[model samples]
Target: MVIESLWFLIVGALMILMAIGRKFVERLPMTGAMVYLVVGFLLGPACAGLLTIDLQCDVALLRTLTEAGLIVSLFAIGMYLRIDLSNPLWRLTLRLAGPAMLITIGALFVAAYWGLGLAAGPALLLASVLAPTDPVLANELRVEEAGDDEPLRFALSSEGGLNDGAASPMVYIALALCGVHTLGSSNPWTFALAIAWGLASAAIIGWALGTGIVVLVTKLRTHYDHALGLEGFLALGLVALAYGATLIVDGYAFIAVFIAGVALRRQEMKATGEKPPNEVLESVERGQREEAAKDPELAHAYIAENMMGFSVEMERFVELGLMVIVGSVVSAHWQELLHWSVIWPVLFLFFVARPLGSSLSLVGSSMDRHQRALSGWLGLRGVSAFYYLLFSLEKAGSATVANLLPVIVAAIVLSVFLHGSSATILLDRYLSKR
Candidate 1:
């Protein structure tokens, strides 16, 4: 009873503090994720002993929490990117999420196999898990608002959004190598086919549901004047629907959720005929509220904006809860982290693999050298990696989890400290220079 009470007290106090001090915190080099992680560490047995988590025993609960966090975050990431699909800016996303991602995976796989002496399956699994930049923790480096498609931020935001889903195929492939039970047959050719189907079908499912739902809602609100003012509920419902629908066909649910957000926002753009200026967006949204159901464009803008707002709120909450959980998990696994095998790969990932791969990938892009360097530096890994780790635990079993947990935890902590502290300061200077 006392422990439960302490949980409430700690959470309530932290929320109040974070709410009141958000702007002040934003000015510091540290992130909200860092603060939450510290608090969670303090709550762990190594400190105040108020919290404990047995990774092996609590795999299901952790998996559910992390999955929920990713679902909300990926949807928000898609909604936040208000750029048109044909904008040359998309090339940047592809560069980072595609070849750059693959290169990073390959680099890590080589390191894990040769340097760390892991078997082929485990090496690939580790590489695949850590491949994508995090959507949740790297919010400071993302596009601040819809329609603010600044090249660096847009590229980072879109890359984070797409790669989380994109990494799903590689993870499944690695699992197949590990002899894990997965969606289809376990052979290489069959796995390749499954990957192709999952990616293609998930994209279709997300697009159809995302685009279709908004059109239906807009029509109902327009002609019948029903189903209005529930944008938050609509956002949650859409993510759930897209996820379930994708999973039903054995497709990648993360991709479906992300593309759903992008499609929803695209529909809004179609309704408005362009990406409205921020001032225009605010005016239209205000007009929408004052005179409900009067303007179709206004409804579209309001729905998209409100849904994006709700998803962002959910994203922050997820970051706080998950960071704390990550901190606690680190507490439980500190010994494993001290091993030489864990430390070197993290250093290699940050110093050599990511930088080399991303920089090489961006060689022909529009970004200047400085921007490319920062982009490579800021591939923050967080909730997405944890989600995959927990997922592997459930599917691939406890032995895999034991082998992978320490390095994953080390990498996430290193990122939270390294990227979290540097992002705001570096971004401020980068923006000031620009």
Candidate 2:
């Protein structure tokens, strides 16, 4: 009872501090994730002993919480990108999310399988889990606002949004190698077909659901002024619908949620007939609420803005709580994480695997060497990796996760410090050069 109460008290205090000191915290050299992580470590048995997490026992609970965080953040990431569908700027995003991502996965798999002497199953799982850049923690480096599509920010932001979902099939492949599912039981044709369907269906379902909801809400509002004043609820409902529908068809929910956000934004932009720069200064401010709603274009923009705001707020809240949990997990397992097996892979990942994959994928693109280097370096890993870790634990059992947990935790810890600290400075310099 005392521990439970202490948990509430500590969480409450942290929330209050965050609410008040967010601006001040933003100015610090480190990020909010770093601060929350250290606080969580202090709360763990290694220090204050106020909180303890059993990775084996709490896998289900942690998976659900982390999954929810990813869903919300993925949706928000989708909405952040306001670029037109035909914009040539998307070439950078596609290269990063598509080829760059696959190359990173392949490179990490080789290092894990050969350098670390792990079995193929575990090696692949580790690679898949760590490959995607985290959308949740990369908030500092993503688009500043809806219309702000600076190439670097847009590419990283969209890549973060796209790759999490894109990486799911690889994770399933890894699980199959461990005999966790029917994929391993089936033939190669079956595996290939299933993966193809999962990818195709997620994109279709998410885009349909996203565009459908926007159209529905806009029509209702046009005739009856309905669906007003609760864009938050609407956003959550859309995420749930897209995610649930995708899972029903065995599609990737992360992709569905992200695509849903993108589709909805595209539809909203069409409704508003407004381009990026025009909407930058016009927010869903209180004074413009009624007038904005009366005009169809403004109405769509209004709801889109409100939904983006709600999603961003939810992403931040989830980040603090989840980072604390990650910190406690680290505190409990620091000993296991401090080994050569763990050290080499992390070094190889950041220095060798990621840079090689990113550089190779981006070759022949117009981005300068400096921009390309920053893109390679900024693959921030956070909640998305944990989601996969807990997910693999649930399916592949403790043996697989045991090998993976240490390396994943170490990578995330290093990323939180290394990428988080340098992203702002590097990005600022890059922009200045531009």
**Alpha carbon deviation, residue 307, candidate 2 (Å):** 0.5
Q: Give the distance in Å from residue 267's predicted Cα in candidate 2 to where it truly belongs.
A: 1.2
C-alpha lDDT score of every prediction, in listed order: 0.88, 0.87
Residue pairs in candidate 2 whose N, alpha carbon or C atoms collide under 3 angstroms: none
Which is the leading candidate under TM-score?
1
Distance (Å) between predicted and true CA of 398, model 1?
A: 2.1
lDDT of 2 by residue, 1-434 (tens): 98788878888999899889889877766789998999988988889877799988999999999998899999999998888989866898889888898888999999988888889999999999999999999978999888686888888999999999899988998888887885333678888888888889999999999998888887777678777678889999999999999999888789999999999889777866656634642665678686676566576777788788999999999999999999998889888888988988988889988888889988998777887898899889889998999999999899777878899999999899999998877877788888
Q: Estimate each model's TM-score.
A: 0.97, 0.96
Q: How would you encode candidate 1's per-residue C-alpha lDDT over 1-434 as one tens digit per residue?
A: 98888789899999999999999999888889999988888888788877798888899999998998899999999998889898989999999999999999999999999998888888999999998999999889889888887999999999999999899888887887898867765576887788899999999999999999999988888877788787889999999999999999999899899999999999888887665635446654454473544466577877788899999999999999999999898777777889898989999999888998889999989989999999899999999999999888888887765787788889999999999999999899999999
- Count of clashes in candidate 2: 0
